[model samples]
Target: LPDIEGELCRIERVRDVLVRRESELRYMMDDIQLCKEITRLKKELQKLVSIPDKDKLKEDREQEEELLLQINKLVETRDFLVDDAEFERLREREEDREMAASLQSKIPKALAVQGESDHESVI
Candidate 1:
């Protein structure tokens, strides 16, 4: 009878230990689920934080496009100015040639008149 009682006591102690261990495992599983939820929330937060960066990048791209357009317009204006300067230079050169031709024709007439006056005085 005493041996049977000892065996029953050992079984009860083992069952108690197993119950305690089961509770500990339940607590650990709950902790694991909480950690997973926290990790998911952190990822969501990171995505939310990056939203502003994405918007800023989009705005920067738009500004860069506007600047490129302005640069192209400036280049076109510069090209027009260069062409106008070349045209003005060509016009001035033509005027100078015309003036030189007129002066040459007048010089020959004046020389012939002087020669005639000299011959009359000599005769």
Candidate 2:
């Protein structure tokens, strides 16, 4: 009887650990989803830095040289901006800011709803 009770206690302890682990897994899954979302946004933002020349302006010698310099600079910046790690950082930061802003915006509305519910309960 004592061994069986000890085994049951051990099983319950394992069950508790499993439940806590499951909750932690769920949170990690959310983080993974957030990372995935950040990746997609980074891809989208990188797409904005297109590698195409769309200007069809004719230029004098000085103007053409200036144009070329500007184009080169843009190309270099685009190259740097399109990096995976850079994009990932930018996307994650932007997502965090957006999430914060949304939470801020919801606060007032949530307060209003809570107030309404409280008033209704009193009535």
Candidate 3:
């Protein structure tokens, strides 16, 4: 009877361990699935956002290059009259460039924050 009881206890311990391991595996599977879903959603979001903006971004870049070329030509000529209006226009363009740069810098930080929030929410 003592040997039988000991065998039964051993079986129960093994059963418990197996049950715990099964639950842990299920949790890991769930985590993997969630990560895959998050990755899919992020890709979809990027596709949606980037597709339309690509053309616009390309156009803007071309325009900026043209503007830079014109500015360089003006500088080379050294005969450009900097009236108040021209000066103001140049200053405004510089400000716009600065603002665009700052916004571009913030975009990655914003995405990082958003990613952190998403991870926290998943947990």
Candidate 4:
């Protein structure tokens, strides 16, 4: 009987330690997520500020708004985790395509537009 009680006590202690570790891991995950969100927001703000063309900046207003919305949502949701892996993947793909298009348009496309309107349309 004493041996059984000792085993049960040991199991309880192990369970308690596991529970504590799990809680710590949850906090750490939250911290990591928060940091990632902050970094993303900073990068987005930097990009928005660095755009040389007013038209390009205006075109990216919606993206900036979305980024701000995401940041705000992250700030508000203290307990809930929002996974944005899929969204990030899609956004990155779109940005890559836009950059490719923009670069391709810069040479012959700019000369064509030089005769008409001075404002260049951004992808």
Best by lDDT: 4
* Model 3 residue pairs with clashes: none
Off by over 4 Å in 2: 51-123
lDDT of each: 0.63, 0.60, 0.61, 0.69
Ranking by lDDT: 4, 1, 3, 2
Model 2: ten consecutive residues of lowest lDDT: 51-60
Candidate 2, 1-98: lDDT as tens digits: 85697598579767866765675566556556655655564554444434234542343334545545555555554455446445555665686688
Which has the better TM-score: candidate 1, or candidate 4? 4
Q: Sort every candidate by TM-score, greatest first.
A: 4, 1, 3, 2
lDDT of 4 by residue, 1-123 (tens): 856975985797678667656755776688698878878897986798677665575658777788888877777664444334345446656866885677677758656776456554431
**C-alpha RMSD by candidate, in order:** 49.9, 18.7, 30.0, 31.9
lDDT of 1 by residue, 2-76 (tens): 469759857975786676567556655655664565556455445545566546566655655565555455556
lDDT of 3 by residue, 14-119 (tens): 7866765675566556556645655554554444455555465665556555655554554433333324335655665686688669769977997899899999
Write down the lDDT that model 4 would get.
0.69
Error of 1 at 60 (Å): 1.2
TM-score of each: 0.49, 0.37, 0.42, 0.52
At residue 5, what lDDT does model 4 achieve? Answer: 76
